[model samples]
Target: MTIFQVTLKNCAFYAHHGVFEQEKALGQRFFVDVVMDVEAGDALGSDDIEQTVHYGLVYELVEKIMTGSRRNLIETLANDVALGLTAWSPMIRRVEVAIRKPSAPIAGILDYVEVRVEHRN
Candidate 1:
């Protein structure tokens, strides 16, 4: 079994996702990274995209989730992305979803708050 990899990094979105009301109202920038291990099957050599997960579909899935609704936690966002990846394609064996909140409502100076979730078959 060959493990094929697909990664989407720095997928950015502006959305309302946070615990505080102001944070929800104002919205913020979020960066999402999705990595997957997939069974390439024939697509590895056949050059047929149908045998593997189409990354465009994956990006659309993430976009729908990131821009469509409001969530209070990046944890939930990460988990949802992981689950969605698996559900989107049976070829996916494992997935890791990372979400970075640049404008996290923290008092102190920091880079960002990130939440990551991993899921497997």
Candidate 2:
């Protein structure tokens, strides 16, 4: 089948998500990326809003997951987000999600921690 891709990358949000007490209390920024594959025919041919995925709504869903609560693992969060998107629309066949934590508490200085997950329904 033909695939239409939608990617929301480097989405930043402030939330309490970490393993440390201080990290949870202070709260920091998290980044999320969502890639969705959907049926391409109708959206590509008609160019109608109804025929395609609404990216804004996708972003809103991601934002809700990001700022909603304190989850210890990006993997769990990513999975939730990916599954959520797939559940949102029947046209969507697969979803890939990446959650990045830049301010994670680590032993030494580092760039960031991230998790990528893919889901199909």
For candidate 1, the TM-score is: 0.97
Which window of ten consecutive residues has the lowest lDDT sum in model 2?
38-47
Query: Model 2 Cα displacement at 7 (Å)?
Result: 0.9
Scored by lDDT, model 1 comes in at 0.91
Q: lDDT tens digits, residues 12-114, model 1?
A: 9999999999988899999999999999799989898788899999999999989887899899988888888888888999999999998888899999999
Clashes of each: 0, 0
User: Which candidate tops lDDT?
Assistant: 1
lDDT by candidate, in order shown:
0.91, 0.86
lDDT of 1 at 11: 97
